[model samples]
Target: MAVHSLLLGVVQGATEFLPVSSSGHLALAQWLLGFDEAPLPFDLVLHMATMGATVLYFWRDIVDLVLEWLGGFVSARGRWSEGWRYGWAVAAGTVVTAFPALGLKPLVERMIHLPWAVGLALVLTASLLFAAGRLPRRGGQVVLSSGFFVGLAQGLAVIPGLSRSGATIVTGLATGLKSEEAFRFSFLLSVPAICGATFLELRSVGSWGDFTAALPSGWLVGAMAAFATGYFSLVLLRRVVTLGRWRGFSLYCLLLGLGTLALSVVRG
Candidate 1:
């Protein structure tokens, strides 16, 4: 179990920030490894670990946003600050994302167990990534409209094979935001999304007793591994986006999606 946890943790961390879907890889990894369904608490722990990595990586932006938001209530000048605008932009994106996520939650959960469906979604993700790469490089600011569209993409990525970072970042890029701005907003949006997911999972666990019972001592090892790997993955992804190499990942997703679909058909 410890080994399995470590393996899954590594898989989750490595894929989470890549254009490839982490949830898709995790589902496939578990299926191929014949591992049992991961407990809810452990899954939440792993997610939180990755979330922590994201936070640490963007700690400055987060702190600035928070301070600015608080200052908005205290001074008129703060209301017009850059950080205030950014905070509102993030809020708008989060609100936009929540709608589709809540509406599609059940369907996504059902699709998670269906490898063929996930494969199809991966193909769709690839298409989006490919299109993003081909878009004209007319860089723009991260406005409310761009934020909404990117958030919509993020919401759609609730599906197992739809990569959240890929979808959001690609959408931002295609919408004319600069690579660095797109990447920054993409991760900033993720902070809330991950927190919401953790909250939902925690609520579903019913009681502290059940949550405690579901967690294994070895889960800590997995969480630590996820944090370490996730931080490095974030660094790599930032460089990849900056270098405009995201299309390379699209090709990988395309082949993997097709192969997974074929395998699912054969097994059936």
Candidate 2:
């Protein structure tokens, strides 16, 4: 991969795992760089890199959950086993949240072309985070309603400048989950959601030949950078969340959104 593409991948990989909106920054970067294509394939590749990092970072959790879910799927009355019951809840949440998101892809793509639309979404994201920070924490309990609500928020984040982590974490907090729990669940929720999106894009291998041919070098660099940055970000976020400092991120988001809006108006 060329240096520019490598740098882009590094940016995507690092930012995607954090509460900051990777897509939003990437769009802005592309526009600033005067790149013709917005690098959808590259975005997918970066997502895949993050997914791999997630698996590495949370391998133990993933293994236990898979084992539990598999045990539940094979058994009758599924609830007979403790592991089986918890597994079903996760599966249910994953499936329920994914459907609406899948249904709305075309709509999201259409809206994303408008710069102001993305700017508005970023502002909305800031609002969600700000509100969530003010609420008192409740012990994290994963319930259907919480799952559904967070899923809806995640769907909304299809717009540029909306962070998936920020949306889900804010919703989780609003639902009264403790900050740590909210953060944990938000990260867990990302596994299936991001993986599904990546799989869909990767399935059509032919359309992405040029991108794929460049992947080996990019993937190595991107994956390592993502893993290093993501691991640290997760740890930092967990600590900051415990301290109830999510409000700082809201300020950051607000500034970025307003800046993007200003830039769009000036350029137009």
Candidate 3:
């Protein structure tokens, strides 16, 4: 594998869990490296790898939610269970956040090709991250309406520079959810959304083999690095959220956005 492939994996792993946008970072990285080829299926592999880790790490929570939903369907007192309500909140949030991105897929794809557009969006993402510090904190449980609002933020995050996690976390904070709750829910919600994206890519490309034929070793290295790095990133992010230290991430995004913009202008 090439050195850049390893770097790509690290970037994917590091940013995938952070409020910083992984896709946005990858886009800027690819541009900086001047890679002229398509990086789709391979990109999907890295994303899928992270998605798997997230699911594995949260398997119990996911399983409990499923069981609760199933039992509620079969039992009379199902509606009274906190598990059932939490499950619905998860599902509702997923639908609210992901649906608009699906609807705007074409538009996002088109805009991402324009570096200037991506640069502008990255600036906006930086602004949101910065604003997170000013948002009021919610006590605990996330309200149902908050889901839609967060989803709307996530929808805008389809742009290359915007961090899905950052957008969602900021939205959650703005809606009054505590940082830890906001972070946890953001990760949990990412499972389905990332899977849906990977699946859509695979469907269009036919299979992993097609992508592998061009860059097998690079893809494998990227995936492994992504998994290892992402696992640790998730753990660290949880701790930071618990400590209410999200302001640093805001600064990081702002600096990164500015740096990318500077590079773009220099190259032109």
Candidate 4:
């Protein structure tokens, strides 16, 4: 169980930001390991660990954005700060993402049990990346509408094969933001989303105490590995996005999707 957790942790952290579907990859890993599905407690732990990595990576921006946004209520100068606008944009995006994502939660879990469905979703993710790669890059800032659209993409990305970062970054680009800005905002936007997910997972577990007591083997090592690998994955993804090299990720997703589908066929 520990070994499985370690591998899944690495998979979760590594792909969570790389425009590849982390959930899909996890499903493949679990399938290969002879597990029917990942246990909920373990899933929650992995999510929190990876979320921690994202928070640490962007801690500075997060602090500034939060402080500036709060300060705006009392200071006129604070209202005009970039952080204020970006903060609201993130909030708006989170609201927009809530509807579809919440509505599809049940379906998303069901899809996790279907490997072929994950493969198809991966194909969809590849297409989205390909389209975004073709769009012209711009230096525009994120606004309410941009947040809304990207949120919509993120909402739909709750599906196992869909890539949250890929979908949001693509939508961010289509909305005219520059590659780096889009990359930054995409992860910034993820903070609340992950928090919300963690909350839900906690609720589903009934209580943190009960949840912790029954934690599966290897959780600590798995979580630590996840955080470590996830941090580096963020660094690698930053370079990839800044270089406008999404087509490479696109190709990777395409091949992986096809291969997953092929394996499904052969096994069935």
The lDDT leader among the candidates is: 4
* Candidate number that wins on TM-score, 2 or 3: 3
Q: Per-residue alpha-carbon lDDT of model 2 for 1-268, expressed as tens digits?
A: 5566567766766667667787777776767766444355666766776777677777887687667667766777654653454355455657767776778779777655667667777887788778877888688666656667777777667677888888888888888877876777677777888877777776665565676664554555655665567677777777777888877888888888888788889989
List the candidates' TM-scores in order: 0.95, 0.86, 0.89, 0.95
Worst 10 residues of 3 by lDDT: 29-38
Candidates' C-alpha lDDT: 0.87, 0.71, 0.75, 0.88
Error of 1 at 36 (Å): 1.8
Which segments of candidate 3 are over 4 A away from where they belong? 36-38, 207-211
lDDT per residue (tens digit) for residues 1-268 in model 3: 5666777788889988887887777666667666543367777878888887798777887787778767899897886675676667667777876778888789777766656667777778778877776676667665566667776777778878788888887777777888877886777777877777777777887655776676645677878888989998889888776676777887777777777777778877
Off by over 4 Å in 2: 35-41, 71-86, 207-211, 214-219
The runs of at least 3 residues in candidate 4 whose Cα sits more than 4 Å from the true structure, single-residue gaps closed, are none
Please report the TM-score between candidate 3 and the true structure: 0.89
Q: List, residue by residue over 39-129, the lDDT tens digit for candidate 1.
A: 8898898899999999999999899888987898899999887677677778888898999999998998888789898899889889988
Model 1 RMSD in Å is 1.4
Candidate 1 lands at a TM-score of 0.95
Off by over 4 Å in 1: none
Taking the candidates one at a time, how many backbone clashes does each contain? 0, 0, 1, 0
lDDT of 4 by residue, 95-156 (tens): 99999999998998898878889999999999988998789878998777877998898999
